[model samples]
Target: MTAAIRCVLFDFDGVLADYDRDVRIGHLAHFLGRPSHAVRAAIYASGVEDAADAGLLDADAYLEALGRELDCTVPADAWVDARRAATHEKPPMLSLASKLRARGITVAMLSNNGLLMAQSWPAIVPALFPLFSGRAFCSAQLGAAKPSPAAYLRCLEALAMPPPATLFVDDNPANVAGARAAGLVGHCFAGITELQRALEEHGLA
Candidate 1:
């Protein structure tokens, strides 16, 4: 008999929550009182490549750095708060996770998130947190980020599941490739509908 898929690991930002890229840019621009393009460039140059991806920079720090780059004074907290308000939970994905659990497949989340944001996430979306019967594998705590085999390995170790029996889903193609290299079946997530179909085809859902 073939070994069954016992676990599914999900990426957080674009997979669980529609990452508000436009809102983030707008917030930085408003804080700096500069054009969005200029603020966006400054944000990229702030030694923080993709704040959400690295999970190192919080909204406040991200806005503050952008403001300083533009020589403007803006309250970082306000900018952060506004951006937070703009975030929306992906209900369909959460429903899919519930279905997976009903079928006895363990579900987990892996994210390249910082300590502060990870800590605050449960409050924003309580349902998402509990869907992971296995705890979340956050990069900041693990000391490694995605697209690095070490991160995926750490998650596998934590889940106590072998990579071949675990399915990894991520929005980034590079991350998906890394998971495959690490021995997990990987999927580049487009949306929940496609993901549900993939899971069904793989006998995971």
Candidate 2:
């Protein structure tokens, strides 16, 4: 028999919010007076971001590295502003998270993001603040990125949730597979409608 799901671990970017890379880059570029392509290359083409996500760099180190790459200082506020500008909230998804909590199912976020994002979640997604307070886990803090079993294990440990009783929801199939590999129930999120149905099947809705 399937273990009853007592917790839901969700991915933040594509699943909880609509992320626009262009908007993020554009905001950074405008803030720093640099070209968009330059900002994009500095953030993506360079290995700085990957290192940050993988926990190889701390927040201060990450920003200093970005500043070196862009040849301009990157303060925490500007970075947070750019991130906030890029993330548009999905009311349906936020509502679903709230509903899950109301149903006695714990809701948390496990995102493949840097420590900076972990610190900025309240400002980035204020609508989710009440529901996910103290529940959001970022890859940098976990010391492992998503699609890695270590990431799921660390998050589950932090939440004090057993893998068998946790449902992992992500927009990426590969991430879902990783969650399954880590002994948690996995759901590949396609849309809010489908997710609602899936929750119903799990007796969580």
Candidate 3:
């Protein structure tokens, strides 16, 4: 709500890039030679994922733990690739980030992802940093995730910016509300055009 916004944090999966979780699940299931439901259930039930995201587990250990939980072994790279398969580029928003960055606006990404995503980011969306300039703030690395006020607040704290000086955009309404709760301006992303309109509405465009 303030005109003094200095940073724009975008959510990766649904904002800058599109991904289908079901596709990732399908790929994991196929790679493991198991049913999709079983794999999905294992992933959710094992609860190793959040630990990995929180940086409590390394990629290798995370994958190994997941395999053990599911009763199947999968190479770490293969598992990363399976997750990568779900992503599709959303270039327009990326270009917009570049544009905003060129204007001296700090553009960055924030996502509720775990360790593997941080390691697999380069392949997931090639040349992401070129557009963003700022570092990718993965929730796993932050020790907090979106939909939690701590997540947004951690980003602001790390960046050394006050909440009023940051704008957070995410596809999830809960995340948007979390940003607001953290004292940053929150924008719910629908599409490129909608986000552009939001920027203008907030006098950031």
Clashes of each: 0, 0, 2
Instruction: Estimate, for each residue in 18-124, the C-alpha lDDT of model 3 and write its tens digit.
Output: 89989999998988898998888767767787787677877788888888877878787777788789888787887788888878888878888887887778777
Q: Which one is best on TM-score?
A: 2
What TM-score, to 2 decimals, does candidate 2 have? 0.98
Q: Between candidates 2 and 3, which one is better according to lDDT?
A: 2
10-58: candidate 2 lDDT, tens digit per residue: 9988899999999999998999999999999999999999999999998
**Cα shift from native, residue 63, model 1 (Å):** 9.1
Candidate 3: TM-score? Answer: 0.92
Candidate 2: worst-modelled 10 consecutive residues by lDDT: 122-131
Q: Every model's Cα RMSD, please?
A: 3.5, 0.7, 1.8
lDDT of each: 0.75, 0.93, 0.82
Q: How would you encode candidate 1's per-residue C-alpha lDDT over 1-205 as one tens digit per residue?
A: 4456888899988897777767877875775568887766765666554553465566556445555677786564555554466567788888887888888888889887655455556654566766763477677656678889988998789878899998899999999999999999899999877888888888865
The residue pairs found clashing in candidate 3 are 53-114, 53-140
lDDT of 2: 0.93
TM-score of each: 0.77, 0.98, 0.92
Clashing pairs in 2: none
Q: What's the true lDDT of residue 95 in model 3?
A: 78
